[model samples]
Every structure is written in C-alpha cells, then in structure tokens.
Target: MSSVLPMDLLTYWNRYAEAPITVEESRERGFGWTQYDRHGPAEELLGQPETSLELGCGTGDMTAYLARKNVRAVGVDISPVQIEHCRQRWPQDGAEFVCSDVLTYLAGTTQKWDAIFSNWGALWFTDPRAWLEPVRDHLTDNGVLVFSCAPPVEGCYGAQGMYGNGFRGRVLPVQRWAYSPEMWEGVLRNVGFLEVYAKVLEAPEPDNLGTLIVQAWAR
Candidate 1:
C-alpha cells in the first residue's frame, strides 16, 4: 500500500471522495473553472500510447478512459478508499489501480511507460523536487509526461493559505501548492525533461485566472 498521509487530510478526503466520480470534477468545482477546457489539452498531449500510467489517479476516471482506448493503463493513488472506489467503478481488464504513495511506487517499478500524466493529484500535496526525477527515470526514452496545476492566488502560498477551506464550494480541507508556470517549466527542465512546454488556459469565468498544462518529453 502507501505511507500514511497527514491525519487530518486523510480524514477529509476519505469522507468526501465519493461526492464526485473523478478528481477533475472536484477540482473544477473547487477552483471555479470548467473542466472541459483542461480535458481537451490533456487528451491532445496524451495522444494514443500503448502503455500509460497516471499518478494520483483519484477514482480512476482518467485511467479507465485510457484503458477503454486500448492502452495498458495503470493508476496509483495514496488514498485506499479512492482506489477501492475506482476499482469498483471501473472493473475493466485493461486498467489496474494501486493504492500506494506515488514516489514509493515509482521507485520500486522496473517498467517504463510510454506516457505518464496526472490531473491535479500528487503535484498538489508534495514538493515536485522529490518526485520529478523519479518520474523521469520511470519513463521510456521517448516517453512523455503531462500534468495540469492550478495557479497560485494572491496569498495562496503563505502560511494562512495552506489550508484551502470551501475550495470548489466544499467544506473539506485540501493541501495544495501553487506555482508559477515559469517555475514549473524550469523544474521540468532541471530534471532533464526535453521539449518542455507549458500551455496556459484561461478559466472561462471572466473574473478568474487559468491553469497551466505542461508537457515534457523524456530524454
């Protein structure tokens, strides 16, 4: 399985994880943005890979979608409840769901994937410095990694902002780290990701900001 998460965070997620079928839904509702905009870019970046993996694949929606398209898809998440829900929801043969810490699972795996992606999962809870290298190492030579992250608001990075209450209109608490698109690009480059690109998509709401969709090819 996975390492223990912060007690409060674990309790919060396990309690509310069933409200929506997928993490993207929760994110869209919490961040005040439409998910369709993000989905298009994600699909385009993903293409059609023979083997794919999703980090922090909450509920396995993305993983199941990939599997339906004939990819050997695997999803890993730290939350056991979420993984259990995912397996129950998508009991297809093409996809596999594992409840494990992303770094721990990546470190132990000898299989390299053609594509790896996440939509607002692990990147939110942990520092990228800890997992980016491991992610790069887990990919095949020509593999691609794609992920989406929300931009930081005025005080989102400060101590007071650590706790996201009423995010996406939910009372549950969430742990998320917001970073600049430039910083994301730099980190991917530093970790040896090639042809790195960050595409910014504005939130449909006139008053809201947008998301950064990043794609990096492994060397």
Candidate 2:
C-alpha cells in the first residue's frame, strides 16, 4: 500500500475521489485522453518488462494492459473509490491494486521492481525528485522507471487557462521548473537515474501542444 501525506487530507481527496469515476470520465471526455491511448516514450522507455508497477493507475485501464503483458502487474492510487472501481472493473488474478499515496508508498517499500510506470499520474503534484527517490531505491539494478509528465512550456491543453477557475489544470504549474530535455534528465539524476533520453514528441493531433516525452534509464 502507498503511504500518502496527511496534509493532503482525506477529506480533500475523498471529496474529489468520490467523484473520480464520474469526474475522471468527464475530464477524459472533456479533454479526450485515455489509458489505452496513452502510449509513447513512457512505455518505450520501459521496453516491455516481465514485471511492472503503475504508480497512479487511475481507473486501472493501463494496469490491465500491463497485466496482459506481464501477469504479475500491480497498481496503486490514492482514491479509495478509484481503487474499488479499478478492482471491480479491472479484475485480474495476477494483478493487484492498492489505495495509497505514491510518495508514502515509496517511503516505506524496499521491494525491487523490474519496471515502474506512471502514466501522467505523477505530474505537478509536487517535486518528483522526492517521490521518485523511492522509485529509484525499489527498482532493481537493471530496472527502468517510466513516467509521463507535462513538458516544459505552454503546450498543454490549457486546463487552467481554459477553465479560468484557478485549479491550474489540476496537474500543478511545473512547466517553469522544466525547461529543456536535460532539465527533466536532471530530475531523474537527482533520484539516481542515469542514461537519460528525452525529446519533444508532438502528436498527430492539432489540438495537442505538450508533445515532448522524457525518458530515463537507471542502471
């Protein structure tokens, strides 16, 4: 299970979590993105491992996909409702889902993973360096950590700029912290990951602006 911070407050999370399935759906429909469609350098970086862990497996769609690839896949999230939904919706004998914060999870666990994957689940919440530390420590010597984050610059769908509600796109405002490809590599290096490869991979859609995908290998 993940060990989330108390400051986040269950009320704050649960307040939103109870509506995750609905809101998550609305956010997806309103934005037009999904786990099945979220493939890029994030997966390519891991390159198909025999074992995988999804940090914030939202509705567990990607977790199911990873389970298909490797029977021993697992996922973790902060929403209890979301975890319940994932368990009921994406039930696989070989897969497991836990409800906890990724930061807390990494703080407690020493289980080495062959591959750790987070699909847009770790962006903007906080400085990833502190959270990814556990990811680095729990990964096998030859393991790979795959995470998709907002690229530096003004290319996102403009959630805040569009909503204008001050929620700030719900992903946090870290673009300023991330400027170049090497900037992302530096974050990974801070957590002990070396051999970084990053690029701004614009998608085939005219509606998308954040196209860069950053990947790093820890060996």
Candidate 3:
C-alpha cells in the first residue's frame, strides 16, 4: 500500500504544470535518470527498445526523446495538466500521453512493452512490494525495468513524507520510497526479476545527494 493520498499526489504534481521543457533544454538534457544534466546508465541499459512505456512521465521530455528515436513511446501521468502540457508540446511527435494513476494504468493495460521505465517517477512514490509484480507482468519476455530516485536517508528506509514546494509555502504531503542499492536489488529479485542490478550514481558535486538507479530484467 502507498502512503500517498491520491488527491494530494495529484495536486502536488499539477503544480509543475507550468514548468516548460524547451527544445534546447530537451536536446541538452537528452533523457537522463539523474536530476543533473549528465546522461546516466539508463541510456545504455535501455538500448533502443522497440516499444517503451514511461511511468510518471512528467513534462514528457524523456517520452518525446524516445519517440524521436523511433521507438513507440507512451507516457503515463496522473496529472491531467501535465498530460495536456505534453500533448500540446508534442502534438505530432508520435508520443502518446495518458492521464492516470500508474497502478491503475498498469492493471488495465493488456499490452506489454520491451522497456518500462520511470525517472524519479512512480517507482519511487509507490509501494514496490505491490507495484513491482504488476510491472514485471506487463513486460515482454526479456523486458527491462529501470528507475531512479534519491538514495535512502540514514535510518529512513521506506516510505517518507516530502513536500512539493517549500519556498512557496504550498507544501503538500507526498510519500516516496527510499532504499539502498542492495535493498532495491533484493526487492526486484524477490519479485521474480531474472537479473537485478542497482547502483547509486554519485552526484556531480560532493555535497549533493546521489541518485539510486535500478535495472531489472523480466524472466
């Protein structure tokens, strides 16, 4: 079970509806797992899947990148505002955007993808014990799952409360799952992933937090 309230989570993400993803920004960033501009291991791990689905695909830049790369890409987000923004931004780009909860969407879809990924997205916010199995079932044979999130805080290894925006005082409660690389690997393997690998990529600067990236292959 997820600690996050559905409506609160929706509202929290809707606040980012105005954040624009410019052409230059997309070109420069170019689909990365880390929050920083540098490309991470996901590019190599994904390896040009014929079809892909992005969970919690926020402004849809990564999804659009996949579409531009000639992959059949679909982006699912809970916020209608975000989905609309994505559609308006890339009307003819061949990337499909759906506004729905990640678990609900996964349960309803009968289609399987070659690659399913989330970038600081649904995988972090949802309960892996319940969420991961469905994700594995939705993949084609030998399919891959990749996701990135902040590493677990010392003494905090499960769902934790986070604020959407602190500066503006519009802080809303949202829950995120944090786990160490080892824990993530164990969790994925327990869910029947044949090959599980998890690592924490060091941040560019010494003082910043690193990104925990996990990749698993379906049996």
Candidate 4:
C-alpha cells in the first residue's frame, strides 16, 4: 500500500509539537486534554507486555508511560517535530520514537507487537479498512487493537471541517473520518478481527454525544 501523507493534519499538529504537556495548558490550547481520563494509561488498557506500539503518538507521553511499565514502547508519529519532542522529553532506554506516517510504517514493518493502541490519533483521518489489515498482520496472536475517537457529532460528516488556526492568521480545515460504532464494528469484523467491542461513553461536558471507545482482538 502506498503511504499518502496527510499534510494538512501533520502541519496542524506540528503547531503543538512544542506545546505544554500539562492538562491545564493543553486544554487552554484546545488539544484533547481529557484523553488521559478517556483511555487511561497504556498498561491499564493492554496490561504490561513485552512490546507495544503507540500509534500516532503526539508527544509520546503515553509511550513514555508504557516504557515505564517495562514494555519496550515504540511511538510513531507523522510529524518529525512531535517525534523530536518525544525523544527529548522521555529519553528512556526502552522507549523509541520514529518519525513516519503510521500507515507506511505499519505496512513496512516486520515487528509483531503484543499490544497496539491509538488515543484519538490519525486513525480518525484514514479509512478504517486501510489500517485494519496492517494492524492484524503486525499484531501477535491475541494482541488487541484499542483506540478512542470523537463519536459522531452534529454536522461532523466526511473528512473536512474547521480544525485549527493556520499560519499567518488563516483557519485550517480538519480531515477525519467519524463513523458510527456499529459501522466500525462491521469493518473490524470484515477485516479479520475475531471479537469487536464498541461503546459510546458520555462526554465529560453536556451537549456532546461523547467518545467512541473500541477494542478489537486478533484471535
């Protein structure tokens, strides 16, 4: 599979490569501040394993957490800036940071991980089918694919919307795929995931539909 760079999304995230890691500072900057609460830590989701991959890891915060738990954690990101931040911030022996498009990296890698996860990462920006097979191929038997994404919201269709402030005061449009839980389950099943679980949890704030939490196991 050819790796198509999602340049717009990468550029938008680059702006936050140097952003603060604190919840208060992140919330102020409009990043997903509640991600920690939504998905918990890596070990909590997948248990302490021998090896794991944090897909689309922004600043490698969760990647660091996984490494701390004695898992050899590899954090992959499309943005070089974010990967650089990860390397500098964590500097752990077991943690590795790679600057590569997630899809391309997955397709080209021979590594089989015990667990793989993404916390509202670029998985939202690509077709579910595109990555499912690669994930299955790269995950060890019984390994799980866990991720959380913005559940469908009012007027969130297709792959484009107002996302961020661009260079020189311009507004950047977002690109993401926000499908329903049932739709996601079907795709996961069709792509060889043995058991698929999906749920929409209430958002912390009212007036929002909530988040879609998904876990599909490789049997």
Best by lDDT: 3
Q: CA shift at 145, candidate 1, in angstroms?
A: 0.8
Question: Which 10 consecutive positions of candidate 2 have the poorest summed lDDT?
Answer: 156-165
Q: After superposition, how far is residue 51 of candidate 4 from its true place, in Å?
A: 1.2
* CA lDDT of each prediction against the hidden true structure: 0.72, 0.61, 0.85, 0.74
Per-residue alpha-carbon lDDT of model 3 for 146-177, expressed as tens digits? 99888888788888876765656555667788
Which stretches in model 3 have alpha-carbon errors above 4 Å? Answer: 1-5, 163-172
Cα lDDT tens digits for candidate 1, 40-119: 34455776689998898887777877787788999998878888888877775478999888898998889999998888
**Comparing 3 and 4 on TM-score, the stronger one:** 3
What ranking emerges by TM-score with the best candidate at the front?
Answer: 3, 4, 1, 2
Pairs that clash in candidate 3: none
Q: Would you list the clashing residue pairs of candidate 1?
A: 29-168, 30-168
Cand. 2 TM to true fold: 0.71
Clashes of each: 2, 3, 0, 0
- Residue 79 lDDT in model 2? 74
- Tell me the TM-score of model 4: 0.81
Which is better, 2 or 3, measured by lDDT?
Answer: 3
Candidate 4 residue runs with Cα over 4 Å from true position: 1-9, 22-42, 154-173, 205-209
Clashes of 1: 2
Using alpha carbons, what is the TM-score of model 1? 0.80
**lDDT (Cα, tens digit) per residue for candidate 2, span 1-219:** 233345434444454445444434533432122223443433446665777778877777666666756647878888787788778766654578889878877777767778787766744344554666677777777887766655666443322222111354332222213446666777678777877776666655746755555556677
lDDT of 1: 0.72
